[model samples]
Target: MSVLVLNTGSSSVKYELIEVESGERLANGVVERIGEDAGRLAHDGGAVEGRFADHEAALRAILDVLGDISPEAVGHRVVHGGEHFREAVLVDEGVIAAVERLAPLAPLHNPVNVIGIRVAQRAFPGVPQVAVFDTAFHHTIPPHAATYAVPPEWKVRRFGFHGTSCAYVAERASALLGSDLSAINLIVLHLGNGASATAVQAGRSVDTSMGLTPMEGLVMGTRSGDVDPGLAGYLARTCGIDADEALTRRSGLLALAGVSDMRTVRQRADEGDEAARLAREVYCHRIRKYVGAYYAVLGRVDAIIFTGGVGEHDAEVRAMSMAGLERLGVVLDPARNQAPSTGERAVSEENGEVAVLVIPTDEEWEIARQTLQSVRRGAPQLGDHA
Candidate 1:
C-alpha cells in the first residue's frame, strides 16, 4: 500500500508518500510558515516560496504538486490519543469528536492535527484516512505505573508520548539481538528535541517517562521535564508567571544553556562554558536516573537503545549518559562508541551483559506501517468527519 503520511504542526505540515510494501519513500515534502509571508513548500527535489493562508491552502498546494499518484490510504500523525485509541483507526465522526475532546491534553498538537485531517478529507474525499497516534503503543502500561499520586477526581495520569518511536526501535532492537520481541526486555531512549525513556518488557510498554503530556520526561530541547509539582503554585503566588508556557517553551536545555539545540550546547560545553556544562550534566544525569529507574522496572534489560537526533549522532552525550553504569552491565567500549558509524549498530562492549545500540528513528515509516496494517484489517471506512 502506498500511504501518504501527514504530520501537522501548529505553523507547518510535514508529509511523506511512502510505499509500504517496498519500504521506499515515493515522495516527501514539508510546507512551512503557514499564515505568514515567508511560506515555503519543499517537495520532490524542488522548492517553492509563497503564501500559505491555512492548513487547507497548504494541503491543496501539495495536492496540486502531487498530481497523479493516488495513495491507497492517508495517515495522520495525531500526537495524543488519550485513553481511547490503542492502535491506528480509520477516521470517522466519532473518532474526530474523541480526538477533539482530548485536545486539552495536548493543546499545542492535537488541534492542528485534526485540522490536517479535515483538510485531507476535502482533498481526497474517498480515500481511507487513518489516525496513527504517538501514544497508542503505550496503551499497555500497567495502571500502577501509569497512575500519579494525585486525587482520583483530577483524573490525569501518565499517557506516554513517543510510542511510535519506542515501538519501532524496540522491534529493531529485537531483530538486532536475534530474539523475539515478545521475549526480550529493553529500554528505549528517544532523545530528540523532545525526549523519553520507555521500559519495554516482552515487547509491551511496562513503564515510560512521559506523563499526561510530552513535557514530563527526560529534559528536552525546550520542554522542562519532571519539574516540581509545587512550581506552578509557587510562581503564581510570587510573580504570576504562567508555569506551563514557561516550562514547556522556556525551560530545559534552552533555559539551562541559553540555547535549545544539543549540538550547540555540546560545542559551548566543550569550550568550558559553565552554564552549558551544567546543562549537559543535568541532561545526562536525568537520563542516567531514568536508565537506572527503568532498569529496576524491567528487572533485566537485554539491550539499551539510543535513538532520535541527539541519541543517534552525539557520541559524547551517549558516553556520558552511560558512564558509571558498568555495575549494571551496560559497558560501552570507548573504541566502539567513539568510532564513526551510522545507521543501526551496536556500541556496547562485546562482553557486556546489555547491548547498547544507536538506531535512528523512522516515525514516518512507522505511521505508514500502522496505517497500512489497520486498513488491511478491514478497519472502518472513512466517514464525513470534517
Candidate 2:
C-alpha cells in the first residue's frame, strides 16, 4: 500500500508519497510561500517555479508534479487531536467536523490541516484519508503529568506535540541500541522551530515538557516556553502586549537575540555578539533543566535521543545541554558530538551508561506507517531502511 502524507501549514504544504509496506519514500517535497507573490515547489526531481495563491492551487500544482502516480491512502498531520482522538483514524464527515470543533485549541495549525485534507480529498477521490495526530502519542501521559494546576472547569491538559516524530525516533533509538523498546527509558529532545522534551519510560510517555500547546516546551525559534502564568496579565496591564500572539510569534531566540534561526544565532554568538550568545545559553539551559527533571522522573534513562533540525546538527547544543551531567551518566563525547553526519549515530562515550544519539526524524514515514496500520490493521514495523 502507498500513503500520501500531507502536513499543511498556514503558508506551505509538505508532502511525501511512501510505499507504506516497504517504508520507501517514492516522492516528497514542499510547496512553499502560498498566498505570496513568489512560490516554489522543491521536490526530489528538482525545483519548479509557480505561484500558489491558496491551498487548492498548491494541491493542483502538486498533482501536476505527481502526474500519473496516485495514493491508495492519505495520512494527514493534524496538530491537536484533543482528548477525543487517542490514535490515528480513518477520516470522514464526523472526523472533519470534530477537527473543526477543536480549532480553538490549535488556532494556527488545525484549520490549515483541515484545508489540506479537503483539498487532498478532491484530488484523490474515493481514497482513504487517515489523520495522524501530533498529540495522540502523549495521550498515555498520566493525570499527574498532563493535568495543569487549575480549576477542572478549564478543561485544559498537556497534549504534547511532535508525537509523530517522537514515535519514529523512539523506535529507531531502540533499534540502534538493539534493545526492546519496552525495556528501556529515554529522554527525547525534539529541537526544531518548535521544540519539546519527552520522558519515555518503557516505551510510553510518562512526562513531557510541552503542556496543552507546543508553546509551553523548550525554547523554540520564536515561541516562548515556560513563562509564568501571571506574566501575561502583568504585561497586559503594563506594556499592552498581545500576550498570546507575542509569546507564540515574537519570543524565544527571536526576542532574545533579534533573530529566530538557530544557525544565525550561533553564527552571531561565534562573532562575540552578546545577545546571540545569551540566546544560545538560554536555549541550552532550558534543555538541560528538562533533562535533569526527566532523569528524576524516569529513575534510569537508557539513552538520550536528539532529533529535528537543531538537535541533530547543532553540536554546541548537544554538548552544552549535556554538560555537567556526567554525574547523571549523560556524557557527550566531544569528537563524536562534533562529527558531521546526517545519519543516525551515537554521540556519547563508547562505554557510557546513558547513550546520546542523533536520529534524523522521519515523521512522514511514521505517518505513512501509521496510515498502513490504520488501513490494514496488523501492519508490522516497516523495513530496517533507516
Candidate 3:
C-alpha cells in the first residue's frame, strides 16, 4: 500500500506519493499559481506551464501526470483542527463538515484544505483519506503553557502549528544526538516564511511559541508576532486597518526591510542597509529570546535543533540568534556553522554542553507515516478502485 500526501495551499498544491512499506517517494510534484494566469505544474522531473482555473483542474492535471500509479491511501495536511482533533483521523463526511465549521479559525487555510480533501476523494473514491493536522503533535502541551490569560468564557488558547515538522525533526535530532528520545530535551526552531520555537522535553512538547494561531509566533515573512494587544484598537481607530490583516500580511520582514525573503534581507543588510540590518536584528532577537525562555523552562538543555529554510540554510542567523548564550552552554562553532552541508550535522563546538544542529524538516514523510499508521489501526479500510 502507498500513501499520497497533499499539502494544499490557497494557490498551490504539493503532492507526493510514497510507498508505505519502503518509505520511498514514488512521485512528487506541485501545481502553483492556481486561479491565476501562467500557472504551472511540475512533476517527476517534467514541467507543464499552464493556467489551472481551480484546485480541481490542478488536481486533475496532477492525476494526468501520475498516470497509472494508484495509492492505497491519501493524507491531507489540514492546518487547523481546533480542539476537535488530537491526532490524525480518517476523513469522512462528518469530519469534512466539522472542518468546514472551523473555517473561520483558519480562514486562509482550512477552506482550501477541505477543497483538496474533496478533490482527492473524488479522484480516488473508496480510498481512505486521513487528515494529519499541524496542531496535533502539540496537544501534549501543558495547561499552563497552552492556556491564555483571558477569561475562561472566551475559550481561546494556544494551538500550536507545525507539529508535523517538529515531530519529524525531534526524532531525527534524537538520532543525531545518539540518545534515547525520551531522555533528551530539545528546542526546535522552525524558521521558514512562518516561524515558531518549540520546547520539547522528553519527546513531548512542553511549550511552543505559536499561540491561538500561527500569526502569534516569531517574526515571520509578513506576519507581525507578539505585538501589543492595544495596537489593534489603535490601528483600527487611526489607520482604519484591520489588526488581523495587518499582522498577517503587512508586517514582519516585509514591513521592516521592504521584502519578505530572508536571503534578500540578509543580502541587503550585508550591503549596509540600516532597515534590513535592523530587521535581521529583530528577527534574531526574537529567536534568541525564545531560546533563552525555553532553556529556563527546561532547566537543563540538551540540544538546540534548527530546521526549516532560514534555520537550516542561514548560518549567520543561527549563530547570531544564539550569540550571547554562552552562559547557557549553547555555543556555535564558527567554522562548522559556515560549512555548507545538506545532511543533518551539528554546528556546535565539539563535545559542547549543548548541541546546535541543522536538521532539514520532512513534513511530507511524517504525514504519510502517520496516515499509514492511522490506516493500519483500523481507520476505515475502504476498498480500492482501479
Candidate 4:
C-alpha cells in the first residue's frame, strides 16, 4: 500500500505519495498561499495557480487531484508533539485532541496541521493516518541537553525540529560510512530555506539547533534564530513593538539584509552589498559555531553530514561553515565540495579525519517509511506494494 505524507504548515501543505516497499515517491507537491488570494496547488509534477481560501479548501482540491492515486495510508508531519508523542502514531481522536491541546506549543504549525489532519481524515475514511512529530527523534536527547535554564512553572524546553529528515540522513550517513549506526556520532546540517544543525549520537538526536519551534538556532530565511531573550522586551519597551510581533514576524535574515530569500541575499552579496555579505557570514558563522558546540557535546565526532537545499547545493556555504575547523578533524576538499550534483556524495578530502557529506534530505520518504513500519508492525497481513 502506498503511503501519503502530508506536512501542513501555517499557510502551506507539502505532500508526497510514496510507494512504501521501494520508498519511491509516486508524486509530491505543495499548496502555497492558503487562505489568501492567488493560492496554488502544485501536484503530479504540475502546478495549478488559483484561489484557496483555507487549509480545508486546499486539501479538498488536493483530494480531487488525487482521485486516481488510491493510497492505503496517510502520514502527517506534526511539528510540535510537545512531551507527549515520542514516535510516529496512528492518528485517532485522542491523538487529534492531544495535538489540539498542544497547539500553543507550535502556534504557527500545530493548529494548521490539525486542520489538515481533520480534513484529510474526513476525505479518506478508515485510512490509517499517522502523526510523525518533529520533536519525536530528539526524545533521545539527554535531559541536560534538552532542558533550559528557565522557570520550572514555564515548562519550557528545547524540543528540536526537522527530526524526520535528520533520522533519514543519519541512517544514510551511517550506511555511507560503512560503520555501525550505533557506534557513529554524526552532525547533520539541515540547511534549507529554514536551517538547523543536529548532533546525532548512535542514530538518535542528542541535540539540535531548532528549539521549541523552528524559530530557534540558525538564522533562517525569515525566522530569527537565537536572539537575546531581552530583545523582545527591549523592542516592546523602547521601540513600541509587541514581543510576539517582533519575533515571529519581523526578524532573521529578513531583518538583517532587508530580504529573507537567500537567493536574493546571495545576489546582493555578489554585487558588493556589505549587509548581504555580513548576513551570509553571520549565517555561516552560526553554523560553524553550532558544529563546534556539537563537537564538544559529542566529544567523538564521526562524519559531518549536510542535507536540505543549501547544504546539498550551495558549495560555498558548506565550505565556509567548515572552513577553519581542520584542527577539529573536519576538512572539505575544494574540488569535491564544488562538484555539481543532486545525488548524495562526500565532499570531504580523502582520509580526512571526519567525512563531510552532502546527502539530500527526503523527509517524505522517511515519514512514509515510518508510517509503513508502524502499520506493518500492527497489521502484518496488509499487502505491501511499490
TM, every model: 0.89, 0.91, 0.91, 0.90
The local lDDT score (0 to 100) that residue 365 gets in candidate 2 is 89
**CA deviation > 4 Å runs, candidate 2:** 9-12, 31-41, 45-61, 377-386
Q: What C-alpha lDDT do the candidate models reach, one value each?
A: 0.88, 0.88, 0.88, 0.84
Model 1, residue 1: displacement in angstroms? 1.9
* Clash pairs (backbone) in predicted model 1: none
lDDT of 1: 0.88
TM-score of 1: 0.89
| Residue lDDT tens for model 2, 308-376 | 889999999999999999999988899999888889999999989999999999898888888888887
Model 4: runs farther than 4 Å from truth? Answer: 10-12, 32-44, 47-61, 376-386
- Clash pairs of candidate 4? none
Locate the minimum summed-lDDT window of 10 residues in model 3.
377-386
Q: Clash pairs of candidate 2?
A: 158-212
Give me the overall lDDT of model 4: 0.84
For model 2 the local lDDT of residue 7 reads: 76
Report the Cα RMSD per candidate: 3.4, 5.0, 3.8, 4.5
